[model samples]
Target: MADAPPPDATGAGKRRGGTSGKVADFRYKRPAQPEKKRRDARSGHERSGPERSGRERSGQASPLPSQMRPDAGAQSRAGSARRQAYAALDLGTNNCRLLIARPSGENFTVIDAFSRVVRLGEGLAASGRLSDVAMDRALAALHVCAEKLRRRNVHLARSVATEACRRAANGERFIERVREETGIALDIISAQEEARLAVLGCHILLEDGRDGTRGPAVIFDIGGGSTELVLIEPGGPVPRILDWMSVPWGVVSLTDSVDGPDGTAAGRAARYAAMRAIVDKSFAPFARRIAPYRDTDEGIRLLGTSGTVTTLASLHLELPQYDRRAVDGLVVPSASMRDISTRLSTMSEAERGTLPCIGDDRANLVVAGCAILESILDIWPARDLAVADRGIREGILRSLIAADAEGERSREELQRARDVTRSGASL
Candidate 1:
């Protein structure tokens, strides 16, 4: 592996020298926890495990489930002692997400997960800056995530900020403040890395060539400030990554740009249409890039990872509340996605808020997000759409673990090579 960039160069390891007055001035009361005991027990076990090893144990302490030990290699890997829980926090354009898991053989079971729509990119389209109201909402959510991270006793944690923070002028300042106040360093990753990690996170969901052969699949992540699309060919060494483009539009950005509160059905339709047109135009280049793969008769499946698609799945199930397991791998028909999009677009903000899936916090912007998803499907026709609740955060965790493993192997290889050279020289 190549040397990692300098700490300051990559925005991953830079530490702000001192806490800011803004951070020191505010005294935050600890939030109440209803399930404190469960959290405490989990953290206690995590703390008792090996400190440096990246291996994660099954959440079950007694014996690993047969289902959890899927393969021989996984079983062998799990035989090792467990280590600290690894945490990945993604502060995206629309949401703040965190995943805590210990490595368990080939796969990791989520010990705890947190997601909340703060719409940090709200008003960023027009203003080119994160709004104060949005920042407050995001900060509150981050505080919750930080507390959870602490309770999990995460030994190695990585927090990242995406498109909204990447584009905003004050993004660095906001990150600095977050570190000083919350002690969470936010890494604003480039679009390429973002695309790579999303594909990695969703790689397991790619269709295996069992029933019938499927061609390359396209994965789309409709984020708050930007959208990422990746094309993957099944049974291939790696995703060819035919094309990846982070469009300057997402749920929050698009909704702020086009939606209105006119309280009229026609107005809402017009808003949806307008938003659709804008997204379609933005996706034109991406469409053209994937056009060559479309004509081959090799069916391309669409896998969507973001709040937009998962929320639509939640609503389709008529779920009273969001369930990640239910929505994660759920396959929604294109027709069904269209139906939900239409229904959501027609409802007033107030009406949408009252719905089970579209809560008060996300009611207004979800339609815009849906429109983006619908527009992409329209352009890139797919047999079925897979919903993934995981994305950047999962990708980050996987990459960090993989990178650490690679680094260790590289060090061993280097030492062996040196020893061989020395023996040859002595002989």
Candidate 2:
């Protein structure tokens, strides 16, 4: 929707504005699957139909992410059909993101990507409804997404709405409006489904524990209106999902719950304490259930895939601004995160706004994220917070790509509770 910035001056899109957003060189932070065979999947009400690769749901082939070859015309079309493009669009409570990509061997190359903070769940915690301004902002972003999908002719695409939509009273009305206005139907996914997709998208970012002594890793997605905590057992082409719980708390909703855009140092600490207390109450039951796994004898691995963790990770690195390459898959010490959170808790709103990563857009809300993050650290008590800048979108890409390699996968891919290998790299 806007012009791309000039090439990176330092050769890293670390600058505030640039196309570094276009093609992310994801380390463990980045980079899907097959056809008609569907399951009573945990990822939502999965619709199993004909083979589609980010193509529109017409049951006709678009030929972007994959190049199908007829037994007869294999040689003639071999070099001609290089690759087809696939896309994943995620319209969450706080942000809207779209990834347009083409399959490259085991991974897909990002050709275009878009992200905007729409805050669709802005006041949902109090009002239990999507506000007018928030809906308008979301609509504008979805328009951009629609234009990108039209321009790219994405082969197979899955666009989803998360906690905000699930909670709001007028959510379906807004979904209808989206279809009417942008030609995009938003599916309000269940919490369990969201947890599953999040895992499919980000578990690879977990620190390796394959030596056996490392405890099962905990992966969490701190969304706008909710947080999905998943326990990932050590195994697979991907990490195994042992158990998961979706707590009803996220940055936007939590911030709305405890209002304090003003106050003294003491007052700010009080606000931060309030936010932390809410998260602690929400996390208590889940924490108790996983008490046996809380031992430190074997060492614990905690991983996070969300804006909260990424923002904190960026701040931990003290970057000039947001840098995906530097932040994604980074292992930040738990102590550094706590120290940053403590300093932020004491900062004035204006003071926090002046920071690079926590700008005006995120200034007020980052504190809420900090509360959630600190609470999570308390529960898992891991030494390092494994951060992933990628999540649900990456998960969708993996699922679409893996459809082709379905039955032929190894025991690791099939068993151990569902981990996948993307772009052929053995995770």
Candidate 3:
């Protein structure tokens, strides 16, 4: 996906649940304000992937036109580009998410979006395979994605699988099953590629240090079975990938590594500490690798696009429900996040589940997320944690739109060359 044009605040144009799904005319909005203002707006509300057995890298999509904000009705060829809807599907270990939009000038206006937590990596760490129950759970969600793709009549789309499929022995088989059962072919992407797409998705929200540089930024994504940490260099339409590494640690994998989220608060606390210790070791090599890039002079900014950070952000704000507008571009103090993680670690499953921000589905798994979060804080220890609700889905969409723009530019250049040739012949 490419850098998004500031989104027009998305509202229900014509939303309703149907056979394909609910809410027609879905709009994925980006804030018009600078990322800082958007982050500041969150002072109130709390807010808050894939087995990739596939190691295939995502090729960049066509470049988008300068006039791409479709919700604004920018002019284009007006024949095909106007009607062509682009789509991106991300099937991760824990969830299935899809976004559909027509290229709206330089940016896209999301027409529809779907997200469901399927937890496909459930029990995979212990089993070494995707379980039948987990497969069924994921398939059901992919079916919905297929329907959205079908209903939208998507012309250009990319669907990908991440760490879960990459790790599960049965990952390839499940990909086949998805194609057979739902007609949605999923490519299992490599860890390196996963890191790239995530950077593509949310790098726009990264804040340059006070000196006005984007380098030395550590952006991470925490999924169900794996956590990806990407070190971004300054410049380019997307952040230059200086270095990246994927640890075999995420909510589902981490939670399962410990005894269940039961037992006394003291027991849970001990488990959390143990989880943190393991993560500390997992991240040590990368920490040493990135030692030179470390800088907090202008500012050390850490951005996270994952459930763990988002949930913790929501908890920090004490919001009644998870809210994207508040969470997406917001930056919170790293200390505040660590404090929230500590609090969650000390609570029982029942207590965490009851919170609107976390709820039952995430109750047990989130503590492991906290451990991962804490471990990250231990390493980067940046002043602020930037949260992005968007990830690979946005990355895929942007890539698709950029591909279109690149193609359009090629045609325009060719036409200009032909016109020049004709003029020379007349002379």
For each candidate, how many residue pairs have backbone atoms clashing (under 3 Å)? 2, 26, 45
Evaluated at residue 320, the lDDT of candidate 1 is: 85
Model 1, global lDDT: 0.68
Model 1 residue 345 CA deviation (Å) reads 1.1
Writing each residue's lDDT as its tens digit, candidate 1 over 1-427 gives 1023211212312222222111111122233444774476346545533321121212421101010111213333322324446667778887777777766666565676666667788778788888889887777677666677666656456677888888777888898777765667777766656666787777666655324637777788888877877766666544556555667678887887874857788888888889988988878877777788876566778899987898899988988887766787788787899888888889888898998766776787798788888888876788678887667667666665555455457867898999999999999
**For model 2, how big is the CA root-mean-square deviation?**
15.1
Which residues of candidate 3, in runs, are more than 4 Å off?
Answer: 1-79, 208-215, 411-427
Candidate 1: pairs in clash: 56-102, 56-103
Prediction 3 TM-score vs. true = 0.78
Best by lDDT: 3
Ranking by lDDT: 3, 2, 1
Q: Which regions of candidate 1 are displaced past 4 Å?
A: 1-82, 209-213, 411-427
Per residue, candidate 3 scores C-alpha lDDT tens digits across 215-263 of 4788899998889888776666666666677888889888888776457
Candidate 3 least-lDDT 10 residues = 8-17
* Models sorted by TM-score, best on top: 3, 1, 2
